[model samples]
Target: MVARDYGQYDGITQALELVGERWALLIVRDLLVGPRRYGELAAGLPRIPSNILAARLKELQAAGVIRRAPRSRIVLYELTPYGRELEPVVLAFGAWGFKALGDPRAEQIITPDSMTISLRTAFRPQVAAELPATAYGARFGGDDLLIRVQGPELAVTRGDGPADLAFASGPGIHRLISGELTPEAAIDAGVVEVLDGPRILLTRFATTFHLAA
Candidate 1:
């Protein structure tokens, strides 16, 4: 049960009472990427107050949304099956929120987990199904992600390696994802830089993963 309960016994109200608190769903978002130690969670959500993180975690655990487990001699917080079911909700919410995203604020930093979920949200599995297998090393600010696309499968993991294309971009990548800029235009405007590999793959990258703005 949530720490607070509304007078009404509605389902949506109950759901909100459980995981609707500030920072709670974001915690679930990172956990969707994978399990993480408490410190790792804090590092991902840098602005979350320490006490708030602890309290949210405890509340989520109590609500059966998450649980703590020992991993490699360290405690890790991970989602339970019920929590995993929130993946689709997060992806849809992310795509819906993308419409309102303008230029990022100066202090807004993109973490690997945020980028991972965003990529998943924007991925065009049907379009990618027709493209050749491709790998990309993507850099968003100080974060690095290895993206592999084969048919309808898409995987974004932390690291960089041999890829069909490697590109670096900050928040301007959003423009590309939102179709505000084409691949060629993005490169010309210096919104995206080719780090390595053939530049043509950048066009494929844009086609394979995009959200209609």
Candidate 2:
């Protein structure tokens, strides 16, 4: 018989042990988006070695953070409900750490509101007649901006801060987009400030928002 070393740790220690590795968090991040096959996970993470990812997946499954789903004959790894609980934690930590590190991943983040707003700002005329003039809320750098079309449908950019909005409130767009604030909570807490028009107008415009396909 062959033996393998399975080190021991207390409850908290074990939790940390599972999540504390450099690449481990990215694994969780990928699964948070949706369940992925082994190859898909490997493809998404270019830096990690296949063997290392395999080990981490096994560890997470063993710890009950993930589970193996049999699709066809091959097994796919997906986060367990318990594992899914870590989404907010992971996203918060990623947001905070990315800010500190000034990583490129920070630039890629866009909130649903921001995404719609940016589309309006960048490509509004394409769908201007289709969009209504509403006080759409946005967040960036932890500050929320209530975007209102006071004049004509105007083009917007990142630099156009402190502009007139129907109303504005809440945390910055950056956090809200990052799952730091759900759309409902943003309104309930009055953190989402508004300006010129009704917030529902913002919701309406958001329907036309698009992202990089």
Best by lDDT: 1
Lowest lDDT 10-residue stretch of candidate 1: 1-10
For model 2, the superposed segments whose C-alpha errors exceed 4 Å read: 1-12, 103-213
Compared with the true structure, the alpha-carbon lDDT of candidate 2 equals 0.55
* Residue 161's lDDT in candidate 2: 49
lDDT of 1 by residue, 44-94 (tens): 999999999999999999999999999777999999999999999999999
| C-alpha lDDT values of all predictions | 0.92, 0.55
lDDT of 2 at 62: 76
Query: Which regions in candidate 1 have their CA more than 4 angstroms from the true location?
Result: none
Error of 1 at 118 (Å): 0.2
Whole-model alpha-carbon lDDT for candidate 1? 0.92
User: Clashing residue pairs in candidate 1, if any?
Assistant: none
* Root-mean-square deviation per candidate: 1.0, 13.7
